[model samples]
Target: MNVFILGLGNVGKALADTLRAQGHHVEGSTTTPAKVESLAQHVDKVHVLRGDESEKLAEASQSADVLVVCVAPDVKKTRTKEEREQHYQQVLEESCKSAANACQRVIFLSSFSVYGDGGEGQEPISESTPTANHDEPSSKYYQRAENHVLASSHGCVLRFPDMYGAPGDLSFSERVKMAIDYFGGNAIFGADAPLYAIHFEDVVASVVHAINEELSGIFNVCDDDNLPASNQQVFDAICAEHGWPALTFLNQIKAPNRKISAAKIYQSGYRVKHPDPNLQYLS
Candidate 1:
């Protein structure tokens, strides 16, 4: 099988390598030329191309068996709110068009942000839950992006929670720094707020599971636990171990604070390799 990945970021590279190791040929695209060297280590072929580049997409996607889109918008690059939204929307639309035209099947990796902090409901977010982010640009683009891929008859969507463990990713260590810098060594959200997240390895495993099972439609890919510990619980443990002043939890910022479910994936013969985030988040 020839797997073509549109982005060679952490999740993309992981997926490419896993498929390659499983005796499938993999090709990938990266926005930066410098990263091609590292991406080449994971896939058989690497192409340096922006997500919206048509000719490049044509070449890289040639003879693709399945095209997995893992492109993430660099929201910091743009200065204004409008620019940010337009940039992401444009790139996603172009990528979707290319994928629909170039590949026989498409797999899209999406974020849980589309659920919009799980809204006022205390129930865990599930695949059946309607997206509640149509107002905000950052959260709303995911809907537009997902729509693009789903337009394809053979498209599959995998929605994941916070993916940690990759370099530069917001893992526990970075969370500590963020605790100090962003939160004044405190938590803006409530201490007991539920934090739905997933380890990077589990993310890769779930993607592989979906591909292997040929599953389609929306699937919320999260850890086995629908309700995980609060951000304060996880951060406080780390803060205490390091002798750093434990972060004071307050209702300063409003963010997602509820359980996220992955039962749909489990019922589909797809089990998370790392079902518990507590086992991996600390490391």
Candidate 2:
């Protein structure tokens, strides 16, 4: 099969490499020309392209058996609430629309943030969970992207948790240090709320699984065994391991404060390599 990835970041690169190893012709796109040569090392071809460019995407992906949207807005590149919202919405919606036009099958990578705070209790979140916090800019943009994807018979949406295990991943230990440096023991993010995570390799595997099985609709792919532990607990554990002081938390009520389960995908024939984030809690 010929696979074309819209973005070639860590997760994208991983999937491209895997597909190539499986005897598929892989092509990837990058926003920067300098990265073209480097990205080509893992795939048959690389394109210098933009997600919102429907014509370019149509041309690049026309021959692809599957078009995967690995592109995500670089929130750091923009300032202001309006700018952030616009960037996210455009990148996601445009990519989905373009991918739908380009190929028979389109896979859009989405975040669990669509659920906002989560289920708030013990029950694991499924694909049907309410994507709360429609008030937030990120949620609004994600929903738009998701809607665009689901609108297509060939499109599918994968809802993932905080993806770790990438080279630049902000792991649990890193978050602990960040709390000390940035918040100065004042508080940890999602201090009192639940947090779920996914490994990068598993992310790649899930995509492959979906493509092989011709999956459609929305699916929540995340760790279930090593599920929701308050960021405060993990932070405290890591801080204690290093003899660091604890931070004060506001004890705020976060919406969508729920654990996510990948059972739907599992039953549909996809399984994650890492279902527990406890390993990060140690490191």
Candidate 3:
């Protein structure tokens, strides 16, 4: 299958490389020309195109057997609520329009943030979990994008949990390091707050499986374990692996906890290569 992956970020690049390694023709698109040189190393071809340009995206989509949109908006940037919403809305509209025109199968990368504040209860969130569009701008934007993709024909929305692995480029360890430097310790959360994670390789496998099966609809692409480890547990794991001091918890932080179930995808006959979260550390 010839797959065109839009947005060559860490996840996108990984997916393209996996497809190419499996003897498929893979092409990738990046917003910057500089990334094209590096992306070409893994994909059969690379295009320097932004997700907002409908014409360029449409042309690229027309040539692909499967179109994957992995673009993510920067949520940390200081911007007005309207400004942030507009940024995501524009990208969602343009990307979906282009894919609808040229691709038979579309995979839109979404986030679990759509399930806003799974507050005060422990529930196994599935693909059918009810979502509320809260005042949070990021959650609203992702909900919009997910809705757009789901409404499209042959579109499969993969709601990914926090992804981490050996790629070493954007691992949780790196983020933890930054947090420690800024706060003088590991970030703390409630002991029961779950940390849903997916290995990078398993993420690629799930996407490839979806493309091959032409499965349409929404699927939660997360590890089977769904270990809801606390922030301290994560810090301990990192410290144990890297030989660092254990972090102290400052205060109990209550976060929205959701146990993402991958049963829907598994029922589709796609096996996950890594079901244990600990295996991610081995890499």
Top lDDT prediction, candidate number: 2
**Per-candidate local distance difference test:** 0.74, 0.77, 0.70
Name the top TM-score candidate.
Answer: 2
On residues 138-231, what C-alpha lDDT tens digit does candidate 2 reach at each position? 6677787788778778789998866778888786777667657765655413575665677899989999988888899999887555556776
Q: Quote the lDDT for 87 in model 3.
A: 72
Clashing pairs in 2: 117-255, 117-256, 117-257, 118-255, 118-256, 118-257, 118-258, 119-258, 120-257
Clashing residue pairs in candidate 1 are none
Looking at candidate 3, the ten consecutive residues that score lowest on lDDT are: 249-258
Off by over 4 Å in 1: 74-87, 90-94, 120-122, 167-170, 182-193, 236-256, 275-283
Candidate 3 structure quality by residue, lDDT tens digits, 106-224: 78877776776454456677778776545555566667666666776788998876677746545677666755665576453433445666777777788888888888999987765
Ranking by lDDT: 2, 1, 3
Residue-level lDDT for 235 in candidate 3: 61
Candidate 2 lDDT at 145 equals 78
> What is the full ranking by TM-score, best candidate first?
2, 1, 3
